[model samples]
Target: MLIRINQDAHPIAPSEITPESLYRGRRNFIRAAGLGAAALAVSPAFAAAKLGAIQKSPLSSTEAPTALKSVISYNNFYEFGTGKEDPARNAGRFKTRPWTVRVDGLCAKPRTFAIDDLLKLAPLEERIYRMRCVEGWSMVIPWNGFPLASLLKQVEPLGSAKFVEFVTAADRATMPGLALPVLDWPYTEGLRIDEAMHPLTILALGLYGEELLAQNGAPLRLVVPWKYGFKGAKSLVSIRLTDKQPATAWNIAAPNEYGFYSNVNPEVDHPRWSQASERRIGEFTKRKTLPFNGYADHVARLYAGMDLRKFY
Candidate 1:
């Protein structure tokens, strides 16, 4: 049986590989381990119960953790820069101290918000979720934060507000990737207002009971588990309530590759690879992909009477 990670024959010695190298884009480590297609449906919790002493629930009986922080501090928050770990390392340079969120468009509370002010209003709760990327790697991340719907409710979405758009900070000097036209920079992503209000959708502030690491989209980020990773924008700078569906970064670039609604469907294949299976981190094993990333029970109703195949 394979005991260590990495497929390269001349792999660097373990002492030479730093902690940072253990993770790059969150789930890259999944590939290093032979997380094969053998055990597809089992989650980490099952394995833990059978093995070591189970960790006591850090939360109240009323609350359960999302998933363990499967991947460490890694993100694609381009505002801090590119490279998997760049955001976590460079995000501190961003002034989160007096951060402001520019709120405009179709909302009653059209105003600017001090970052601290927003954090203070919500009753924070931790949700342990299995975050799966479209790239076929997965991680069980225990994301700590409050329900995002609570924030949207505060904005008092207008009747005409059909969608929500997020724009990240755009100082090209600090964010070298801004010069690339591959994507309209400052990186913008959005969700239908209905999807924005979904309980699973999160405007996350912290993780693992600590303030968010800069690379993990410090200050604020969006988390939508059922969809692919990109749906969750990081280091949010502005929020706009729109009357029509906003042009999203991934969908705009390749409509065929990414759909407006990026739900996790094992049957749907990305342009580059099949989504029928995924490699879950920590487990060092492969797992089957669920219809909606295993949140189908919670979110299936949202898409009732609709065809996921066509939208995905």
Candidate 2:
């Protein structure tokens, strides 16, 4: 007799799929996922297949996402707005079946990619990292996805391509967040070429080992762990590599409040709040914010010549 493998049982997050052999798990894990308990549930044996439970860095324990924290608090689908539970409550209206990413500007091979095409390019890996938010909150997200740099490299940046700009999906009906003039409805963000290539930055499709939900910017979103949460724009619909710095949504909202860099610097406080302390979401919001979101050593060099305060 052959055991029937259920797809949802072994439903690993899109980015975590490749880090381990998804098919190698006990068939029971797959059955469990399909039992209506949850979708994309993984077996205990496969949990450690990626980065596992070890904190990516000592500074980020509170910030690093864990198995428990990953599911309970994650999925930043802001289409429904800023409510923490909005995504889970209101994101179902989003239609993600025919998603596509249009890539253009300063590249030899400009093309549109189906969501699946991008998923297949890189095997998913779960990375536990500090996620600093401008709202003085942070989380240790066990993010699953290949580095964003991997995808940017495919289009091949030209000599003048200095920035990477991402545009969000434009559907105001489902995404009530777009209804407000909060940074031009369809959100957008940009990173300097060097920052875009940072190893820690990720174009994530899911969190906590499952496909991203609609309110969580389903289909695709960026996770730049070192920057303020808003810096990692969501609901990406287009990517453009430009010679000039594109006007980012948050930066445009309040230039003084948000800088182009938007790096998580406790020393440089947001105009509205102290960046010194962040509520690591599930961790009671009293956690101290780490410099560079605990990736300063890996990302500090990118800002070598200039003062972060001035640039930010």
Candidate 3:
């Protein structure tokens, strides 16, 4: 069932959107710095390159998007580093091109798709989604990509495929944080077959109308806005359809703290933080955290008859 949320009731005006020229100008300034990847990684002036034609999606949220600077600079890509700003400061040399995603396991048409081929597979759309972190912070980001279902359908899962596992790229050379004994290397995430095929779940390629920066999971990433940001695995390398629930990075690292289904539930607080309210990025005040990050009406049915507190 395709469920459309009401968040898009107030569509953003064209004038409110950031201009592409501004991003190009920022890229030019970074080029002039001549500091190469190091400069690009640390400089707040660095911006993503422009993408080809894109179509606006009706699934977008009406909330004002967080500034591009904050969206790129303040990140949680632990493959680069643990600090919130570490991704932006350390992912300067990370490579994303020539990337390919392998889709296999319990599927009839298992095949590896190059990043270029994936881009051409479907028409890209802009989806402004509300991202909620387990740390109690949030951001409304304009993500550019196509529905994950669009790609999953191409492989055609078998009846035995009950879950989907996502494996991220873990390059020791480019990702320095791999040296540290953090959660685990090659971050992994998963979703039930129904959730995987949800219309709102997208495979993001870029943000703010530009190709994604290395710090932002360039080339490809999963974006499930209803769940905590950690559920959106970055720099994905493989997608496997499995009969058993695959172990995820966080859930494996701390099962008590991070559940397999990390849906946004205001009633269920994080072990270290409260999930009832959240501080939106760039805002001084906190707002009530909506169930499923304000997508309850569209996604609540997926969890019907299940105890969120227990399953969460």
Most accurate candidate by TM-score: 3
lDDT of 1: 0.70
Q: Looking at model 1, which ten-residue stretch has the lowest summed lDDT?
A: 44-53
Worst 10 residues of 2 by lDDT: 42-51
**Model 3 bad stretches (over 4 Å):** 1-47
Q: Give candidate 1 misplaced runs (Cα > 4 Å).
A: 1-70, 79-82, 89-92
In candidate 2, what are the lDDT values of residues 181-285, reduced to their tens digit? 656657789999888888778887766666665655667788888888888777789999999999988778788988899988989987776788876555543
Q: What's each prediction's TM-score?
A: 0.75, 0.78, 0.87
Instruction: Arrange candidates by TM-score, descending.
Output: 3, 2, 1
State how far residue 187 of model 2 sits from its true place (Å).
0.3
